[model samples]
Target: MIEPVELIGLAAGFLTAFSTVPQSIRIIRVRQAAAVSAGTYFMLLGSYILWLVYGIIQGAISIIFWNVIGIILGAAVLIMKLFIWKD
Candidate 1:
């Protein structure tokens, strides 16, 4: 019953949402974030937050679901970059 475009959106959202997993895992495994850019993650987190808000306003479940995941994963990276890892 799902439309083709909706399926595409879901697929794209899934890809972008989980894209940060590898970076998070790497940071956790190595326990270092010298190569990570705080500013970039900051901006990315902000963008994800905005998208999440928009999704809420628009009642777009796909956007809401994927952006939540993106926010969580992105925040993990930012947190590690700012707090956990020294550099």
Candidate 2:
């Protein structure tokens, strides 16, 4: 049986993981990199990696699932900021 905490984690994970879409859309729409900081994205990527690792260690599927997606989205943003930004 799935625990209540696991369900909560799943919900929170889904919300947080998908929350980046708006920011990414804004960046793409405006073509503006002024507000996007490379260091911040990198830090977020690093933190997500750590969270993924922790999820693996804890055998928490919710954490693993969310952080995996978070890593992908975060990396996408970081890459866009790196290549698309003109500084």
Q: Number of the top candidate by TM-score?
A: 1
TM-score of 1: 0.91
Which window of ten consecutive residues has the lowest lDDT sum in model 2?
15-24
**True-vs-predicted CA distance for residue 6, candidate 2, Å:** 3.6
lDDT (Cα, tens digit) per residue for candidate 1, span 54-75: 9999999888999999999999
Cα lDDT tens digits, model 2, 1-87, are: 989997887788888787667778888899877878889888888988999999999998878988999999888888788887657
Clashing residue pairs in candidate 2 are none
Candidate 2 segments whose C-alpha is farther than 4 A from its true place: 1-4
Instruction: Return the TM-score for candidate 2, rounded to 2 decimals.
Output: 0.85
| C-alpha-based local distance difference test score of model 1 | 0.90
Those runs of model 1 whose alpha carbons end farther than 4 Å from true positions after fitting are none
Q: Provide TM-scores for the models.
A: 0.91, 0.85
